[model samples]
Target: MCYVMSYIRMAMCVILFLTLFTGMCVADSKGNLALNGMAVQSSLGHPQGDAQNAVDGNRDSDYKKESCTFTKTEFNPWWRVDLGNVYTVSNVTITNRGDCCKERLRGAQIRIGNKLDNNGNNNELAATILTAPNGTQTFSFESVNGRYVNIFLPGNDEILTLCEVEVFAEKKLLINI
Candidate 1:
């Protein structure tokens, strides 16, 4: 009887562990939250380079393809996305222009938070683009809670362009006791 009880207890423990593990995996697989979000920029560089292009689920680096966003040369040009609701963002993936002038994104700041002050540019500084890349780059850091993600280029006569901006996050799970 004792042996049967111990075996049953061990089996129950394993089952519980598997259940929790599966939940966590499901939460993390929610995919890119920014795909359904809304995007905006400080100024439009061209009609084809609208802010909405960044979240249109296309990562084409060529600005001519109209899949990237562009801002006119100005001080502190910024692009932002509203994620609809607050979420614990895990990482952000940014695709830079590949056709030319990929260096325009250098020194860009990635800020995340719920505050709309300064058009969400005053949010928590999550990361910075230290180097320009011709392809996609993913920036991961400690999870940040926010409904807005802003990419601010702080400098004089700076132009901000983004081929794609993908935001990935784990959904908050509520467990009932």
Candidate 2:
């Protein structure tokens, strides 16, 4: 009877560990709420490089081919997205143009908040990319609540080209204790 009780206790410990571990894993997966098909805008009005191309679910990375959006070289060139409703954002993924001139994305600041004032530049600073990447990059920051996600490139002679922009957020879950 003692051996039987010991076996039961061991089994219970294993079950408890698995339960806790599984819950933790699930928590991370629940934070990536897809923000596809959302509205996108840019400071420059390129006929072929419209802001909407960034969120069209394509990461073509070829700006010359009109696969991404491009802003006219200017001071503080910016791009923004509207999530329609406010959300608890977990991260922002940006696909940079890989064909050429990837360095144009350097020193880009990502801002997130509900405010639309000042072209969304007044929003909260989420993260910044020190080195411009040639491919897809994910910028993860502490979860923030916002409806507008804007990317600003500070300085003159800079153009903003984006192949794609993906916003992930935490989904609200209701739990009854």
Candidate 3:
């Protein structure tokens, strides 16, 4: 009789512990609720899920496994996501991509908020267009502010190669809003 009673008490303790743990888990998932106010965008191969993925695409960790190369060209071209908001970039991660893929890199550009193309104005190029290094580079941007971002790819006569180019930034809250 004592053994059975002890087992029942143990079972009760487990059930209580599980219930409390579940509550804590819920709070952890919804640790902080953010009110939508600023732009949050990215093209790090996938949707914006974390700060580390600021710039998007495959990186050294996984690129070798998949024979697929990240590519940019004049035809399909590279892209810059508007993130639906503006942010102050803190870091940038560029993953080595492409064996040059089916397409090639002409050149690539990235820019923060500026009225270049949107104004129907031409001749003015992107404010922050970048040249992919011969090798691979992980770069960062700090102390700059802008809203719209631009990415330009002026295809090299040969093809350019890349896996992913990611930008990391801290979301800025607009007081005017």
Give each model's whole-structure lDDT: 0.87, 0.78, 0.39
- Tens digit per residue, CA lDDT, model 3, 1-177: 999999999998886776566432111111111112222222233222222222334354234445123332234334444433334554444444434332233245454553436321222233342444443454555534434444444433332234445555554422111
Top TM-score model: 1
**lDDT comparison, 1 vs 3, better candidate:** 1
Model 1, 75-160: lDDT tens digits are 89999999876678879999999999999999999999989899899999999999997799999988888789999999999999
TM-score of each: 0.81, 0.74, 0.42
Question: Where is model 3 more than 4 Å wrong at Cα?
Answer: 1-57, 60-76, 98-107, 114-131, 134-136, 155-161, 170-176
Q: State, as a TM-score between 0 and 1, how close model 3 is to the true structure.
A: 0.42
Q: Each candidate's root-mean-square deviation in Å?
A: 6.6, 8.6, 14.3
- Which residue segments of model 1 deviate by more than 4 Å? 1-29, 173-177
Model 1 residue 62 CA deviation in Å = 0.6
Q: How high a TM-score does candidate 2 get?
A: 0.74
Model 1, residue 6: C-alpha shift (Å): 31
Best by lDDT: 1
User: For candidate 3, what is the lDDT?
Assistant: 0.39
